[model samples]
Every structure is written in structure tokens, then in C-alpha cells.
Target: MKFEIKRDRLLDGLSDVMKAVSSKTAIPILTGVKMDVSAEGVSLTGSDSDITIQTFIPAEEDGKQILQVSEGGSIVLQARVFSEIIRKLPTNEVEIEINGNFQTHIRSGKSEFHLIGLDPLDYPHLPDVQEDELFTIPADLLKTIIRETVFAVSSSETRPVLTGVHWAVKDGELVCVATDSHRLARRKTKLESVQDEEHNAVVPGRSLNELNKILDDSADPVEVVMTSQQVLFRSKNILFFSRLLEGNYPDTSRLIPSEYKTQVTVNGRALLQAIDRASLLAREERNNVVRFSANGSDEVEVSSNSPEVGKVEEQLLAEAIEGEELKISFSAKFMMDALKAIDGQDVVIQFTGAMRPFILRSALDDSILQLILPVRTY
Candidate 1:
């Protein structure tokens, strides 16, 4: 295989696909990136069985040439070394050549490197899920939804299913739900679907995080295809595929209480900043717990007390506080995460009771919700 390509374009493609390569994989080939050059363009692929990413550099985009293919063939080169070489090359253009024996040579300016390449034939074939079910959404909106909820996914591997975010379709709306037992995050949006069918899938949060990094926040739509075992997200010339986690996501509908004892509307930034200051003292405690207490309908106190680090107390005026007055303690980290995900000026916190899980939501939109379990502090 031989190709002369723009270094910036190649580097961008490599950077996108490199997220799939796992250096600790048992299969040595999985640690490398596969390059294929054809008359159409150049394609780079990286995978670690669970996730695969492929990016293509077309010969011409918008009437401008981005790559020049001299021959049609394939080769696999060590990902770390190949990526470093391409990134550090001194020129805007890079030339790559591969011999029949898989010896790969890369040249730019006066710098050259010969790398032992593997036959691309040995690379595991990515699963081809027929496009039976497909949907499209704006890339920026999708990234925003992911950012709001993916962080709530369980980091523990004991129950592998909880490590992924649950996606479900109902009434033309797509909802993403993530939880780590202590807190939960949910985001919903309207999606274009082909049929009146309900679709449910659990996608790994790690894969979504990686996808978010590579996807540009543009108005362009991203096409998604799904099978029972896998899901694929396509944007422009890039393809991202991930294996679905095999297990039923916990039924979370019942976890969200239908009613509340108290509801208070407070400034999102004010509450976030208050919790941030409280966390400084709470960090010395067992669970980084912070306490919130409401005084009538005027102000709310955010405080934390540490046996070794003293205490901190801050008061923020509430826009409206009603119903039963409440005092609740919860993880400051969880509260801060929930606050950051809310996308409005004022946030509404619904307290079921002192010990029950409370919810945080934007005063303007009901599509997004964050729930945190309160700790018992005597």
C-alpha cells in the first residue's frame, strides 16, 4: 500500500480512531492501527473487540484534494509509534509505502522510519449489522445529552450492565438513563425513527465518552444503526461501533417518586458554588456529605461539618420555597454533578423526605432529571 496524505488530515483521523486501540490487549494486532489505501481514499481503523472506530480521508472534499493514493492495499502498524511519527513529522504532507513482506516505510522531509507492519487480513472483521433500525439526531444535541447523563453510569465492573447508559425509545422520544445506585441522571429528546417500535439498549459509558471526544459540535446529523448485540454511530466519514452490554438495565421508573414533600427553586450557580465551598470541608468526612436546610420560603443554608476540618455554612436566597420545610444531607460531589448538568438559571429540588432520594431539575424543562440519595446525618 502506498499513499501521500496531508499530515494534519492523517493526524486527525488517527486521533479519532486511536481511542479504540488498547495497549493491554492480549492480541498483539489489536494494539495497532490498520491502514487501507484505495482509489477512493484512505481509511484508518482501530479496535479492541468491544469498540471499533474507523475514519476516512477522502481524495477530495468540497473540490479539494486531501489524499493521493498511488496503490491499493492494506497494512497494520504499531499504533503508538505510528501515531507519534505522523504527529511529529516536520512537513504538511506525509508519504507511506508498504512492501509485499509488510515492511512499512514512512517519510516526511529528511526524517524517515521503517516499521514492521502486519497483514491487514489478520485484523478481526468488525460486525456488519444490517441497517434494519436507524435514527438520526444533531451531533451537538447528542453530545449534550451524553454529557448530561453518561457521567452517572456506574464505574464498578461487578455488575457490568450498570456500567453502561440505558437508551430507550417511546412515543418518538429517546431517553438516556444512567445511575450508579447513589445517583441517577436522565435526559430525553425527540428522535427520528422509522417505525412505531420500542427499542432498548445499554451502551457502555466509556464508549460514549470516547465518541463524544471525537465528534464535533456541529449542526450536522449523526446516523445511528442498531442490532440486538451492537450499535453503530456514523458521522460524516467516521464510523463508531460498540458492542451492547448483555443484561437488562434496572427498571428505574419506580425509583423516581411521583410526589414530593417540598420543592424549592434556587439559582443553579449559587447552589453549585455553595456546594463547592462546602465540599472543601466535607472532603475530610466519610462521604463528603453536605447538608441543606430551608428556612421558611426565604433562604436555604448549605453547610458541612467535619470532625477534623471544622465546618462551613453558606446561605443562598431561594426564589420560591414551599411545602414542608426540610433538612437533608447528601454527597456534595453528587450534588455538584447534578447542578452542572442542569441547563437553566433556576433549579428545582424536590425532597421526598430526609432519607429518600431527592430530584433536581431545570425549572423550564422537564425532559432532564437528576436524583441523589440523601445520607442520614444525626
Candidate 2:
């Protein structure tokens, strides 16, 4: 195989697909990136069984020759070394050649390197995902959806399904929900291109985070194809694939209470800062617990205490407070995360009781909800 391609374009493709490469993959060939060069263009692919990423570069783009393929062939090169070499290449143009023995040669202005590549035949092929079960979402919206909820996904594998974010579409509304049992986050948005569809899939949070990094922060629509076992995200010349979690995601809708006994509206930034300060004292307590209590008709107190450390107390004026009096204790870190994900300047906290799960959400937006189970602090 022989090809000469623009170094900048090749680096872009390498950086994207490299997200899927893992050095400890059981299959030796999975650590390498597959390069397919044909008369039309060049394709780069990387995978580690769980997630696969591929990017393509056309031979000619905008009347400028970006790739010149002299022979049609395929080879798999060590992802780490090849990516480093291409990144540090001195020239703007790169020439790559592969011999029958899988010996790969890379050349740039005043620099040359030889790498032993694996046979492309030994590399695992990506699953043939069907396009029948598919929907489209804006790239920016998808990124937001991942960021708003992925943080709550369980890091422990005790319940495998909690490590994934549940995606469901109904009546043109797409909702992404994630929880670690202690905390939950849900985001709902209306789809512009996709029609009424009812589908539920739990996608690994790790894979979604990786896909989020590769996605462009643009409004361009991204094609989301869901298969029985795999999920595909296609945007422009890049494609991201991830294996779906096998277990059924628990019903999270019931966890959100239908009504609340206490409702308090406060400035989001002030509350976040107060909790941030309180967390310092509670950090040594090992739980990072911050206690909230309704102080008066128009104020709430945020405080924390540690036996070996100090105590912190802050009183914030609430925009409005109503319903029965309430007091709740929760993780400062979780509260901060919820505050960060909220979009509006004001935040609403609804409490069914001091023991029941409380909700932190935007004052004006109803599409995003964050729920946290209170800690039993005597």
C-alpha cells in the first residue's frame, strides 16, 4: 500500500480514532489502527471491542488534493507510535508505504521512520449495525445531553445498568436519565428531525463521555443509529460506535416525586458558592455533607461541621420560600454538580420531607431535573 496525504488532515483523523485504542486490549491487533487506502480516499479505524471510532479523508476536497493513493491496500499500525510519529512530523506532507511483509515506512521532510504493522485481516471488523432503528439529534444538543446527565452514572459496577445512561424517546421528546442511586440527573429535549418513536437503550457512560469529546460543538444534525447490540453516532466524516449495556435499566421516572412539601427558590451562584465553602469543613468528615435548613419565611441556612475540623455556616436570602418547613442534608459534591448542570440563574429546590429525595432544578426550565437522596445525619 502506498499513499501520500496531508499531515494536518491525517493528524485530525488519528486524534479522533485514537480515542478507541487501548494498549491492554486482549486481541493484539486491537491495539493497532486499521488504515484502508483506496482510489477514492483513506479511512482510519480504531477499536477496543467496547467502542470503535472511524474517520475518513477524501482524496480531493474543495478541489484540493488531500490524499493521493497509488495502490489500494490495507494495514494495521501500532496506534500509539504511529499517532506520535504523525503528530511530530516536520513537514506538512506525509508519505506512507507498506510492504508485503507488513513493514510500514513513514517519510516526511528530513525525517523517516519504519514501523512493523499487523495484517489488516487479523483485525476485528466493526459490527454491521442496521440503520432501520435510527434517529437524528443536533450535535450540540447531544453533547449537552451527555454532559448534563453522565456525571450521575454509577462508577461502581455493583449494578451494571447504573453505569450507563438511559435514553428514551416518546412523542417527539427525548430524555436521557442517569443515576448512581444516591443521585440522579435527567434531561429532556424535543427532537427536530426525528418523529414519534419509543425506544429505550442504556449506553455506557464511559463510551458517551468519549463520544462527547470527539463530537464537534456545533448545531449540525448527528445521525444516531441504534441496533440490538450496538449504537452508532455519525456526524460529518466521523463515526462513533459503542456496545449497549445488556441489562434492563431500572424505571427512573418513578423516582421523581410528583409533588413536594417544600419549595425554595434561590440564586444558583450564591448557593453553589456557599456549598463550595461549606464543603471544605465537611471534606475531612469523609462524606462532604452540607446541611440545609429553612431559616425563616425568606431565608435558608447552609452549614457543615466536622469533629476534628471546623464548622461553616452561611445564610442565603431565598427569592421565595413556601410550603411546610424543611431541613435536608446531602453531599456537597453532588449538589455542586447539579448546580453546574442547571442552565438558569435561579434554582428551585423541592423537598417532599427531610427524609424523602429532594429535587434541585432550574427555576424557569422544566426540561432538566436533578434529584438527590438525602443523608441520614443524626
Candidate 3:
């Protein structure tokens, strides 16, 4: 394979695909990126079995020539060294050449490097999903949905299913849910392709986070194709694929309560800052628990205490308070996560009881909900 490409253009495509390349992959070829040069453009692919990312750069776009291919072939190069070389290349132009045996040569201005390349034939091919089931969502909306929910996915590998976010489609709504068991985040949005379609899939939260990073905030819709075992996201010249997590995601519908004994509406920023201050001392504790006490009809106290480090107490005025006064303790980190996910200036927290899960959500937008399991402080 032989190609002359702009250094910056190649770097941009390399960065996007490198997100899928894992340094610790069991297959040595999986740690390398596959480069395919054709008559029209150059294609870069990286995968680690779980997630695959591919990017394409046309030979010429507008009046600028991004890549020029003299020979059509493919080769796999070490991702770490290849990415580093392209990033630090001194010149704006880069020339890459590969022999029939896959010996690779890279040159830019006076700098030159030779890398032993592997035959691309050994690299695993991406799944050719033939499923006709697909939908389109605005890139901005997809990014918003992933950002608001993927944060709650469990980081522990003990429960493999919980490490991914559950995506459920029913009626005309698409719901994304994630939970670490301690807390949960859920986001729902209405879809234009309204049908009786019912599909449920668990996608790795880490993969979704990477997808969000690669997606630009544009008005163009992202094409999403869903298969039983894989999901593909395509936008512009980039394609993202992820293997669906096996096993049924636990039914979380029952986890959200239908009623609440105490409800309070408070400014999201005010409560977030108060909890942030209280957590300064609570971090010394094992649970990092912060206590919320509704002292009056219009005000609530946020406090935390550590036996060794001391204590803190801050008050926040509520926009509205209803039902009986309530006091509860929950992880400070969970509260902060919920606060950041909410879009409204004020938030409504509904507590069924101190022990049951309570919901914190935007009072104006019912599409997003955050639930936190209270910590036992007694």
C-alpha cells in the first residue's frame, strides 16, 4: 500500500479510530490499526472485539487534497507508534508506503521511520449486520442522552450486565437507563418513528461515552442500526459499532416508585453547592454520606459529620415544599451526579420514605429522571 496524505487529516482520523484499540488486547493484531487505501479514499479501522471504530478520508475534498493513493492495498500498524508519529510529524504532508510483505515506511520532511507491519488479512473483520431495523436521531440528542445516563453504569466487573446502559424502545419513546445499584440515571426522548416496536438492548457505557466524544454537535441525524447482538452508529464519514452485552438487563421499571410521601423543589445549583461543601468533611467517612433535613416549610439543611474530621452544615431555600418534613442521608457523589444531569434551574426531589429510593428530576422536564438509594445513617 502506498499513500500520500496530509499530516493533520491523517491524525484526525487516527485519533477517532484509536479509541477502539486497546493496548492490552489479547490478539496482537487488535492492538494495531488497519489502514486501507483505495482509488477513492483512505480508510482506518480499529477494534478490540467489543467495540469497533472506523473513519474514512476522501482523496480530495473541496479544493484540498487530503490523500492520494498510488497503490490499492491494506496493512496493519502498531496503534501506539503510528498515532504518536502522525501527531508529532514536523511537516504538513506525509508519505506512507508498504511492500507486498507488509513492511511499512513512513516519511515526513526530513524525519523518516520504518515499522514492521502485519498483514491486514489476519485482522478480524467487522460484523456485516444485515438487519433492516434502524432509526435516526439527532446527533445532539444522542450525545445528551448518553451523557446524562452513562455515568451511572457500574464500574465493577462482578456484574457484567450492569456495566452497560440499558436501552429500551417502546411505543414512540426511547429510554436509556444506567445504575450502579447505589444510584440510577434515566433519560427518555420521544422518537419520530412512532410504532409498536419493542426492542431492548444493553450497550456498554464505556463504548457509548467514546461514541459521544467522537460525535459532533450537528443538526444531521445519526443513523442507528440495531441487531440482536450488535449496534451500529453511522454519521458523516465515521462508523461506530459495539457488541451488545449478553444476558437480560434487570427490569428496572419496578425500581422507580409510583408515589412519594415528601416532595421538595429546590434550586439545583444551590443544593449542589451545599452538598459539595458538606462532602468536604464527609469524604473521610466510608460512605461519604450527606444528610438532608427539611427544617421548615421553605428551607432545608444539608449537613455531614465525620467522627475524626469534624462536620459541616449548610442551608438551601426550597422553591416549594409539600407533604411532611423529611430527613434522609445519601452518598454525596450520587447527589452531585443527579444535580449535574438535571437541566432545569430548579429540581424536584420526591421521597417515598427515607429507606426507599427517591427521585430527583427537573420540575419542568419529565423526560429525565435520577434516582438515588438512600444510605443507612443510623
Instruction: State the lDDT at 16 in candidate 3.
Output: 97
TM-score of 3: 0.97
State the lDDT of candidate 1 residue by residue for 160-215, as single tens digits. 99999999987888999999999999998987654667889999999999999989
Q: Can you give the lDDT of residue 111 in candidate 3?
A: 96
Q: Clash pairs of candidate 2?
A: none
lDDT for each residue of candidate 3 in 64-164, tens digit (9 for 90 to 100): 78888888899999999999999998999999999767788999999999999998999999878765777789999999999899999999999999999
Q: Residues 1-378, candidate 2, lDDT per residue (tens digit)?
A: 899999999999999999999999789899899999998999999999999999999999999999998888999999999999999999999999998799999999999999999989998988899887778898998998999999999999999999999988788878999999999999999877675667888999999999999999998889998877899999999989999998989888899999998899999999999999999889645688999999556889999988788899998999999898888899999999999999536999999998899998898888889999998998
The TM-score values for the models, in the order shown, are: 0.98, 0.97, 0.97
Model 2 lowest lDDT segment of ten: 191-200
- Model 3 gets an lDDT of 0.91
Q: What lDDT does model 2 reach?
A: 0.92
Error of 2 at 142 (Å): 0.5
**Per-model CA lDDT versus the true structure:** 0.92, 0.92, 0.91
Output the lDDT of residue 275, model 2: 94
Model 2 segments beyond 4 Å from truth?
none
